[model samples]
Target: MRLSSFFMPTLKETPTEAQIVSHRLMLRAGMIRQTSAGIYAWLPLGYRVLRKIEQIVREEQDAAGAQELLMPTIQSAELWRESGRYDDYGKEMLRITDRHDREMLFGPTNEEMITDIFRSFVKSYRQLPLNLYHIQWKFRDEIRPRFGVMRGREFLMKDAYSFDIDAAGARRSYQKMFLAYLRTFARIGLKAIPMRADTGPIGGDLSHEFIILAETGESGVFCHKDWMNLDVLKDAPGMEDDLQPFFDRITSIYAATDEKHDPANSPVPESDLVSARGIEVGHIFNFGTKYSKPMNAVVAGPNGESVPVEMGSYGIGVSRLMGAIIEASHDDNGIIWPDAVAPFNVGLINLKSGDAETDRVCAELYAKLEAAGLEVAYDDRDERPGAKFADMDLIGVPWQLVVGPRGLKNGVVELKRRATGEKEELPVEAALAKLLG
Candidate 1:
């Protein structure tokens, strides 16, 4: 993509309303723009990152044996009523009435609707152990929506529902999802620690919130220092293997939000405890028969008895993850995007754009990089070299390949790594090879 034609409207100064690092950086980097209090329009650059994160979540869900499906954003009020939560869900739910005078709502979550869907076609234990997932937009009317997409009222989410015949089967599904979340965050260059969480009115001990530690996080957390060194992607068990040991190993790690922390009775010693702030990015609940039983989503058992199918709901904040990533990865200049989630693999800069030799070298390198199956952002605009460098750093592409008349005359180009701020001058061929590798 060429910067001159790209629709990224970057700002030179920070917006006063943005209180957090992620929110401020996102605005100045031209990743997103606030349309309302908490609603945002993702611009070209931001949209690319959003889609990349969504794809990663989708791939991880698929690898865990979940089938993908689409669900509507608007839902019937009758469904929530049947699940006994319409009245209890409170003001966060955006309730509305259609012209037909029928009650409707922009769904905050999909438990009730998914249960209704399950009971419609799935009957008997034959379809047991089924997992259905979707990536869609959701809305909740936050009283004080702030911090950009981090606390947005409208956001994209990936929610999956798992149905099993009994508690034992449900536990296995939960374990699979547990490992799946670990691998998902790890792939996105985040070390998310799973901590036990409250199940709320649904009432179950089988609940966890996956949190990533960041200085700008909202919730204070306490965990074992060992969590810092554990590489979940390297050590996680296979999806089909016995996951009990892996599940136990992860849950046994002393990690808890401040609300759940008990210092007097904690197992970890003082020296090993790492108290820090964290952001919750994903949550999984193994709420047996909570939605199914209330909504009468039953199926015939092997013994020919009617039984309520055990259900679990897992959710990952697809859009909020963008802010979380920025919070965890950015430096003073701007966001330091992870390689897997970066919008472009490389930023190609023609330091002297009007110079024939500089343009020729940059264009050649851009073509070669693209031919090697890389996403390259070529800055072909008539801009100053300093402005080009600053913009490249702000958008946080993993690498910046710099070409200038002086460098071209010397038969070399400059390659800089965004995250490490390290640069090397080499022949154009060598630079291309390094980027490809």
Candidate 2:
């Protein structure tokens, strides 16, 4: 991508309405724009990051044996009514009526609809332990939607539904999702701690919320200090393994949101506890018959008895994660995107764009980087060096390669790592080799 023709409309000043660091940085960096009080229009740069995150979530879900299938944004209110939650879901659900006077709604979640789908085709226990997921837009009419995408009313989400024959099978599915969520966050360069959380409207007895600690988090959290040292991918069991032991070990780590924390009753010593603010990015629930029984989503058991299939729902806030990442990773200069989720892997800055030598060097490097399967943003505009540097930093590409007439004359180019602010001067071949490696 060439910055000279890019559509990024970066702002020089912070918007007054942005109260949080993520919201302010996103606006100033031209990643997103507010279309309404709680809705945002993701621009090109932001959309790239969003899609990257979504793909990560999808990959993890697939690896955990969940199949992908998109669901509609508009849901039939009859389904919600069948699950006994149409009215109980409250004002957050955007209830509507079609021109023909049939009730409809923009779904906040898909428990009811998914249950209905399962019952339509799936019959005996042969189809047990099935998981289906989708990445789609969701809406909740928040009374006070603020902080950009963090608490936005309209946002993208990945929701998965798991169906099992019984409680034991359901727990297995839950554990798989638990491990998958941990791996998903880890791959995205986030250390998300799974904390016991309330099921809320989901009505589940067993639930966990995957939270990443950030100063700008919406809620306070308390956890065992050891959670920071744990490497989920290294320690977790395989997909086909008996996950009970792994699940037991993780749930015993003593993490909790403020709503569930009891300092006096906590097992961990005060000294071993780490209290911090955290943002919730994913949530999983094993709600055995919550939706299935109410909606008659039953299947024949081994004993030939009809039973409600145990069900679990997992959800990741696909859009809110962008704000969370910014909150956890940004610095005074701007966002410091993680390598896996960066919009562009590298930003090629031509300090003197009009200079033939500098432009030639930058163009060559850009071509090489792209040929090596890297996403490169080449700054080819006739802009000042400082402005180019600032814009590169603001957008948070993982690396920045600086080329100038002086550097070209010296037979070297400057490379900077965005996260660490480390710089090195190396020959063009050396730089290419390092980047390719």
Choose the strongest candidate by lDDT: 2
Q: After superposition, how far is residue 53 of candidate 2 from its true place, in Å?
A: 0.2
Write candidate 1's Cα lDDT for 57-153 as tens digits: 9999999999999989999999989988999998999999999999999989898888888999999998788999999999999999999999999
Where does candidate 2 stray beyond 4 Å?
none
Candidate 2 accuracy as lDDT: 0.93
lDDT of 2 by residue, 56-126 (tens): 99999999999999889999999998999998999999998999999999999999888888999999998
Give the runs in model 1 whose Cα sits over 4 Å from its true position.
201-203
